[model samples]
Target: MRREAMRHRLTEEFFARHSTVVAPDLIGKLLVVGECSGRITEVEAYSGADDAASHAYRGRSSRNDVMFGPAGHIYVYFTYGMHFCANVVTDTVGVANAVLLRAIEPIDGIEQMVNRRGRSDNLTNGPGKLCQALGLDRSDNGASLLSGEIGIYDDSWPDRSAGRAIVVSPRIGITRAVDFPWRWQLAAERNERNERRRPGGSRTP
Candidate 1:
């Protein structure tokens, strides 16, 4: 299959269309790094000021500065002084909205992800875990998912059809955004496939 070029990658409008729509659509998509790839599993939506669950609900700050920037940019932040979470900037340039990338099934660089996570199943199972597996840190905060080393690809995985994909309730983690039902969890097929491909198979959240 031909790889999608940078120009064909997702644009700002692509992200602003409606996070609930975009979240499930992102399932089964390929997040590529060099030869490695990961199938997106879980995602959550945070609207701008309208949604109290969103960080932009209050206003921009040193930590949420990226959400105010262009859409499709990575907005990664460290929380609890120990975990790192990641979000994809969305909405207009000034509108502070984002989609949190909650989990992924390692499709490539499993060994590297394992090393970074220090545990096989733990790798890429949560927001922070997936970021660490992908080598995402504060430096990549404003990085665009459209181009450069860390880019998204349309792998056109055969099983991504709507009927095959399963959508589940959001994971119970956040306190402030507890009531919102916008979070989405993708099925485990991708992770199972990855384990079959790599020995010493494992599972993740």
Candidate 2:
């Protein structure tokens, strides 16, 4: 019998949905940047025209044109004049909605990520930190997730059996839309108690 490797990749249709739908679902997905891989632990959603916090809220520009491209592409940009942050393009061809990959749990290439970040703590715990640890820069902007050096795979899916629960909170590291509870993360242990109290389990938003 021919051996077949288990594989699962999120399709463009998956990303073509609203950012809110894509954000929480991204948790537990695998982000593969070159040889480094991690399980997505956190993400924040940004609506293009509706969200004041979105880069394309006022319309696209030279720097944010990639955000308006087709879904399933990467949108990397420089920030703080010293660090790079990355986001995943979402919605339709003209829509600029996206989900910012806030943090991840390292699963592969730990040594390389540590070397890049020069420390282990918070290596991929923030937008900029995750980009740096994964060696993602502006050059990776507009890269297609379907065929590129960087890709997201659904190799592992978080569920009750995985002992994890999704938590939603307002986005961090931003002033605009700070009150919007659009951030999502995996609660490793707290969900057990929540699951017992909440009927029909938790739901993503």
Candidate 3:
């Protein structure tokens, strides 16, 4: 099948809603950072002020002020004192909600991503991993997704298997709010297909 060459960027209006509403919906979307692009495969939602796991739960600080900004902006931050993670701010200003990008299915600039991460099997299967692979860090914080170095695009291709592809689980790597099923990811079969579609696989270019 021939693929179409087009990118429909998601509008800010799409993100001016609850983080939970946007988290699972981001699956299958395309995330672009400079020359690299990938299909979003996993994400976690964090609602500020109430969600104990959220950074904004205790109110705004210099480090988390971006989370309370307008929607459709990147909110990059450092964690574990050594790793970086990226999130997409959601909801209207002052809401302080965001969607953490956990994993992505590399679709463009695969060689670059592999070089950055030194591995392909789990290049972007985790938040910190994906951030490193995409060269995102504190410098990318508060960047507008509508017209910035980091952006999410609509794949345009019809995904008839989306319902079967998505699965939910409690957010990982977090000790608080463990009961909320706020994490979403592509199913194992979908991940296998993604791997098979890579450069040296049967679906090679």
For each of the candidates, the C-alpha root-mean-square deviation to the true structure, in angstroms, is: 5.2, 6.3, 5.2
The global C-alpha lDDT for each of the candidates, from Candidate 1 onward, is: 0.71, 0.83, 0.86
Ranked candidates (TM-score, high to low): 3, 2, 1
**Model 3, 1-205: lDDT tens per residue?**
4544667889999899999999988988999999898888889999997899999999999999999999999999998898999999999999999999988877778888899998876778788888888888898999999986678888766543356567788888889999999988877552275421334545333
lDDT by residue (tens digit), candidate 2, 1-205: 2211434777898889989999988888888888898888889999989999998999989999998999999999898899898899999989899999888888789899999999966678778888999999988999999876788887733322265678898888788988999989887454233111334666544
lDDT ranking, high to low: 3, 2, 1
Local distance difference test, candidate 1? 0.71
Model 3 sits at a Cα RMSD from the real structure of 5.2
C-alpha displacement of 60 in model 3, angstroms?
0.5
Cα-based RMSD of candidate 1: 5.2
Deviation from native of the Cα of residue 9 in model 1, angstroms: 3.0
Candidate with best TM-score = 3
lDDT score of residue 148 within candidate 1: 81
Highest lDDT model number: 3
C-alpha TM-scores of all predictions: 0.81, 0.86, 0.88
Q: Model 1: per-residue lDDT, tens digit, 1-205? A: 5344322455556776566677766766677756556877778888767777777788888878898887778888988788788887776778887788887777678998888878877677778788888888888888888778776655654435335555656435666757777877665554455221324556575
